[model samples]
Target: MKALIVDDEQPVIVSVKLLVDWKKYGIDTILETTSAADVPALIRTEKPELVISDVQMPGLSGLQLIAMIHEIHPPAQIIMISGYSKYDYMRSALQQKCIDYILKPLDEDQLNAAVGKAIETYRVEASQALIEQSYDFLHSELSKKRAQRLFLLYHTSHQTSVIWAQLCEIMPAFSSMESCRIGILPTGHLPSELFSGARDLSLIVNFIHDLCYETGQSIASEEPIDRNIHILFHSELSNIPELCRRIVDAVREEFHLFLPLGLSPAAPFPVNFSDAVRQAEDAVQTCGLMYTRQPVCFSHVTGKEAETPPVFRMEEQLYTAVLNGHPSGIRIAVRLCLSDLTSGKGLTLRQLLLFRTAYIGLRMRWIESFRMNHKTAASLDAPPGSYFRLPFRDDGQYDLSVMEESLIADLSAISDYLKGVLGMGPASQNLFQQIEQYIHFHYAKHLSLESIAEEFSLSSNYLSRSFKKKTGSGITDYINNVRIQKAKELLENPEIKIFHIAAQVGYSDEKYFSRVFKKTVGMSPLQYRIAHTAILPPLDLM
Candidate 1:
C-alpha cells in the first residue's frame, strides 16, 4: 500500500522512513508531506491507502487534517503517531476511527503492527468492493460517494484481479504483472507451547507478511482459524516445499513464534480448490492437537495409522474399530491392511482417500453408537480422538456424504461389514460375538440378572460380577449394549419410526432413545446415518 508520512519535523519523517523497510511491506513509494497544512491537497491527489502522521503539527494539526480528509474520503484509514500524552487527543483520534495511535519514540515492532493492521483494513475493504454487490443511489453527488463506500465489506473469493487492481492503485509498479498465486496463511489458535502470547503471534504475523512481501508474495488476510495466523500470498518461485520450510524457520527466528504450518499442496486442478482449503484446515487441526510439530501437508499431518486403508473392506473394519473404543486396534488394523496394499511402502492418493473415509466413518459410527443404550454401547462407541475429519466432494467420484447416507440406510449391512462378512469370515470367531448373541437372544425375554444366573447355574450376584469382569462392564451394561445396537438397526430402517426403534430396542420411550443417540453420535440417529451412509467411492476413477 502507498503510505503517506505527515509530520512537522523532516528529521522524524526521515527517521521513520529509515527505520521502516518499505520494500519488505510491498510499499513502492513513501509519499512525504511534513506539514498537516499540505495534507488536504496531497491526500486529494495521492489517495494513499494509509497515513502515518504526528498529532501535533505547526498548522492544520493531525486531528484537523483527519477531519478534513475524512470529509472527502470517509473510508480512508489513518493511524496517529504521537508523543502527546493527553487522553483528550487520544479520545478524539480514536473516535475519528484512527486505526491506531503509536506512542513516539516509536517501537519498530509496534509501528509494524499498526501499519499491518491499517493495510489489512484496506485490503479487506478493497477485497469486499471487488466482490459481488449491488449499488444504491439517492439521485445526488452524496450517493456517488456512498456507492463508493459500499466497498467496506470484506470477503475472500481467491480474486487475483481485485488484488491486482489494488496493487496497481496502491503501488503502480506492478499494475501490468501477472502469475502470482495467492496463499491464505494459517492464522489463530497456535499451540501455546510454540507461541508465548498473542503479542508474540501478532509479531509473527507481521513478520510473515514482511517475508511474503519481500519474497514477492503478499499476505492477504490476518484472520485467525483453528489455532494459527492466516495470510494470503501469491508467488513466482518454484520448489514451494523448501519455501514453506523457510517460512517456519523465519517465524521461529524473527519473532520467537513457533508455528506448525500447513502449506496446501498446490491445486493442480480447478476442482481441487475446496480440497486445498481442507488441507490447510487439516494442517491446523493437527497442530491444535499437537499431533505434529513439523511443517506438513494435510495427508501426512497425522501418524502412519492415518494413512488411509487400501480397500473398502479393511477401511470398514477399522471404522468399526473406532466404534469399539479400540484406537490401537484401528491403528494396527489399518497398518496391517495398508501394509497389504502398499507392502508398508507408502500410500497412493486413492489409498489415502480410502483411509480418510474409513477413519471418518469409524469416528462417525462411534458417534452413532453413543446415541444408543445397549449394555455394549459404551464399550463400542468412542471418539476419533485428536484427529478431526473433513471429507468433501470435488467431483462425482468423491461422494463420501452419499456413501455415509447409504451406509446409514442399512446399518445392519454396515454391521455385517464390520462383522467381516465376505472379508474376515463369520462373526462367530469374535468375543464381540458372544456379547452380541447374548444381548440379541435375551433382550426382551426377561433377560435381567436373576434369570441369567439361574440359566447359567450361578448366583445372581456372582453372574453379574462375572459378566462385568469379562466385558469390563456389568450385566446391565451388556443388556443395554444389545438393546442400543438393536435400536440402531431399527432406527436405520425407514420402515420403523424412532418410537419403534426405542421399543424394539427394549425401551418404551423414543424421547429417551433420542437423548442417548445425541449423546453418542453428536447428531440424531437419523442425521448420523444420513450423513455417513451417502458414501461416494474414492475420486480416482475419473
Candidate 2:
C-alpha cells in the first residue's frame, strides 16, 4: 500500500518516480528521500511495504540500508539499484534478501515487472495472515460454545460426574481449579437493535473472552442468555474487580454502552457452579437499581428479601381488568403495579422484568379461556422471554418515564383487541385507531405484522386484511411511514449522530435508513438535514 525510495541523486529520484506507475501496484503513498540517512526515520513513521534504494549513497550504502530495513520491518520487500553490475554487488544484494537487483540507468520495463511481483507477494502474505486469524477466531468460538453446552447439561442432568468429565475434556484448566466465582454481565438497557444480529453478539462475547485472557484468567465456563453472559472465573484470580472495570470501560469506549457485572461468593469449582450462577444473577438484579457501571457482588447487597404479596395483588387486579374488557382499567392496573414495584424497598429490575413476564402469561391464559368459551380461532402470540428491558437515561440511571410509556402502550394494545372481541367497544375504525397509536408508541422496536397480530390475538392474514380495509394502507407501509416520520424529526437535531437516529427510528442499518428516507422524502438524511438546518454563527470566546 505504500513505498519508500532512497537515493542521494534528486534527478534519479524524479526519473524513477516517472518511470513506474505506483498506483497500478496498489501503492497509494510514495515517500522519497535524497539522503540514505533519512530512510530509517521515514520507514519507522511511514511503514512502507516496499523499498527501492541506490547502492551508493552519502551515509549508508545500499547493503546497509537493506539490512536495516530487514531488522526494522522483516516483511518489507526491497529492490536494490546499483551503478555497478559486479557479481559481488548482486550476490550481496541477493544475500540480504532484496526482492530484485537492477543496474542503474534504470530500465522502465524491468522496474515495473519487479514492482508488480513484490506487490503480489505482499498481497498473498496479507491474505494468509487474515485466513490464519479467522481460523483462530472460529476455533475459539467453538470451544466456548462447547463449554456452554456442557455447563447447561451439568445443571440439568442427574449424572453430574459424566458432564463434569466432558467439560474437563474441553477445558482442562477446570479440573485443576479448586474454587471459583461466577459473574453475570448484562448488556444494560441499550437499544435492542444493537444486539439483534449474530455478528454483534459474537463481537461482545469475543471482546470479553479476549479481555479475560489478557488478565491472565481463563474463563472456566460462560453462558449467554437473554442479553446476559455468565462468566466463571477461578477464585485465586484476585484481579476480577479490576478486570470488570476494564471490561466496562472498554465496552463503553467501543460501543457507547454500559455493561453491568454482578459477582457471586466463591464456591467449590464444578460442584457449586449452578448455585454460584444463581447468586450472581441475584447480585445483578439487586445492584441494577443503583448500578453505575461498576461490579456488584452478592455480599455487597444490603436489603431485606422482597415481599411478594403486593405484586400478587396487582397481578390479580390486572387480570380482572383484562377479563372484564376494561381498557382504561388495564392502563390503571399496570401503572399501579409499576408504582408498587418501584416504591417497595429493595425493588430490583429483576422484579420488574419478572412482573412483565408474569403479566404476559396471565394475559395468554385469559385469551385461551376466552377462545375455549366462545370457540374462537384466536390465540395469543408467544411472548418474548425478556420483554421489559429496563430503560435507562444517558446518566445510566433508570428512566421510569419511558418504561411506563412503553408498558402502557403494550398493555393497551392487548386491552383494545379484547375490547373489540367482546363487542364492548366502538366500530372497526376505532380498533384501527388504537393500532395506529400502538405503532406510534413503539416504532423504535422490532415491529412486524406477525408480531402485532400475535400481540392482539388475531391471525396475521385477518389482521392484515382488516387493517388494510380500514386504514387504506398495508400494516408494513404504515410502520415504515411512522418510522420515516420519526427519523425526520430526529434528523432535525444536528447533535444526534445519523446511526443513532437510525437505531432510534427502528432501522438498525444506517445505509438502509438513508435509502428509505430518500425513497420516502426525495432526499438522503444528510441532505435533508443540511437543507432544513439553520446555520448558527460561532460563539465568541474572546
Candidate 3:
C-alpha cells in the first residue's frame, strides 16, 4: 500500500510519517504533502491506495481534499485526522466512506491501526475483484455451453479457475508424461466437500504433488480440481498397485483413519483427462464402507466386494442393534458380517467401508444416546459445532468410515501376523494350544517351566515368542495372573491354610511361594489371605 500523509502543518506530516512502522503491515513507501491543495495532485501522481489527511487545513479542508482525491483516484482510501472530538466532521468523513479517523497527538499504535484498517479494506476489495473476475469467466464459459452441458461442468466453478491460474504459475511448461511413472492417486471424499466449508485443503493438493515427485514419479502439474488433485505425469504409470499400497500404508501410518487407494480404473497420464478424474472419483467412492475390504488398485488389502455377500438389508438391523447398545446385536452383526466373508467371495475395499461406515455411524449414535443431553447424533466431543469434532475432510485422519476401517485393518493385521508366525502352522499351533489347555486344567500340578516348554516340542525362546504373540502376553505373566486369580479364591476359603494354598497353586515350598506372591500381588500370601480370607463357596475343580 502507498500512504499519502496530508496536513497543512509540515511538522504533523513529518511526525505521522516517522510514527508509523509501515513495513510491519507489508507497506514501506510513505508520501508527505503539507498542503491540502497538494493532496489531489499527490494522490493522482503517486496513485497512493491510502490517504491520511488533516481535517483542518489551509484553503481546502481535509474533507475537500478527500473529495477531490476521490473524484480523480476513486481507489484511494481517505482517513481524516482531527484536532477536536467533533462528531460532525467525523460523521461527514465516514459518510463519504473514509477509511477511519484518528484524533491529534497521534499514538504509534493508533496510526498503525488506522493504516492497517485502510490496507485491510483495500485488500478485501481487491480479493473480491479477483473472485468476481473468476466468477465472470465461469459464467461466460457457461454461456457458451448448452444447458445440459453446463450442469456437467467442473462444479467448483469458484475455486477451479483460481487454482488453475496457480497451476499455470507452477507448471508453466508441460504437455504430458513420457518418461517416469505417474500414479494419479485418489482421495476419499475431499473433492465433494471442497465447496462445503470443511477445512483448508490446499495442503492436500500440494502433498500429493510432492509425494509423487519424491517417490520418483515425474509429475507434471500441481493443479487442484474441486477438492481432488490431478496427478499429471511427464511419464508413464507403473506398479500402481504397489504405489497404492504404499500410499495407503503411509496414510494409515500418519493418519489414524484409512481410505482405499484405487488403481483409478485407468492409468498412465497420457489418458483421457476426464476419465482419469471420473475413475479417480470412483476410487475414492470405493473407500465407502461396503467396499472397503478389497482394494481395486494400489491402495491395498481392502474388502473384496464380490466376495462380500449382499447383506445391505441386514445392515440397518445390525446398526440399529449397535445404536441401541445391545452387545448381543453387535455380536450377531459381527458374526453375520464375518459369515458373509466365509463365502470366500472376499470383499473389495469399498464394500468393507460400507459395512464399517454403518458400524461407525451406529457406534457414534450409541454413544450419543448415552449422552442424552445432546440433541444431534454426532459424537459428544463433536456435538453440533464443536471445534474438536470428528473429521469429514477428504484427507485428514479420523474420517468416520476411514477410522473404523483402519482399526479393523489393524486388528486384522494382528490375525494376519499370527497366521504368518512359524509356530502357527497347524501341527505346531495345535500343540501350543493343547499345551496351554493342559496348563489351565492342571495349574495345581507341580508344573515346571522346562516341562511346559518341552511339552510343546519347542525351545523355550521360540515358545516364549509364540506364546507372547498369540496371547499378547508372556506365558509366565499369564500363568501368574491366572494363578493369582485362583489364589484369591483359595485365600477366601478359611478352611485352607496359606501353606496349603501355596502347595495347591503348584508350589511345594511355602517361603518361595510367599516371595513370588509378594512380587506378583505386592503382599505375602499369608497377608493376602488375612486381608481377604472370608469363607466362600468352593470353586469348581474343573
Model 3: per-residue Cα lDDT over 394-511, one tens digit each: 4443344433343334333322322332122333345554455445645777565666776545688887888888778788776776676678888877777777888788878877
Error of 3 at 100 (Å): 58
The regions of model 3 sitting more than 4 angstroms off are 1-173, 176-204, 213-230, 236-260, 265-271, 281-311, 315-326, 341-343, 356-542
lDDT of 1 by residue, 1-542 (tens): 57889988888898888877777767787899776667888788888888888888886676787888788766578988888778888988889889988888988888888877888788888777655343222333243222222211122344345643554453343343343322334433222444455545555655665565454443433444344455333334555556666777766565544445566655532345445656665554443223224454444433333443554556445444433323354456545654565453322233444555564665464445433423454455332243322222211122234434433333333444344421223433443443444455447555677865654456877777766766687877677666766666655555555565666776666677677767655777667555545443233311
lDDT for every model? 0.55, 0.72, 0.56
TM-score of 3: 0.28
Candidate 1 backbone clash number: 48
Better of 1 and 3 by TM-score: 1
Q: Candidate 2 on 199-220: residue-level lDDT in tens?
A: 3756777677666654444552
Query: How do the predictions measure up, each by TM-score?
Result: 0.33, 0.56, 0.28
Q: Per-prediction RMSD in angstroms?
A: 21.7, 25.3, 23.3
Model 2: how far residue 374 lies from native, Å: 9.9
Best by lDDT: 2
Choose the strongest candidate by TM-score. 2
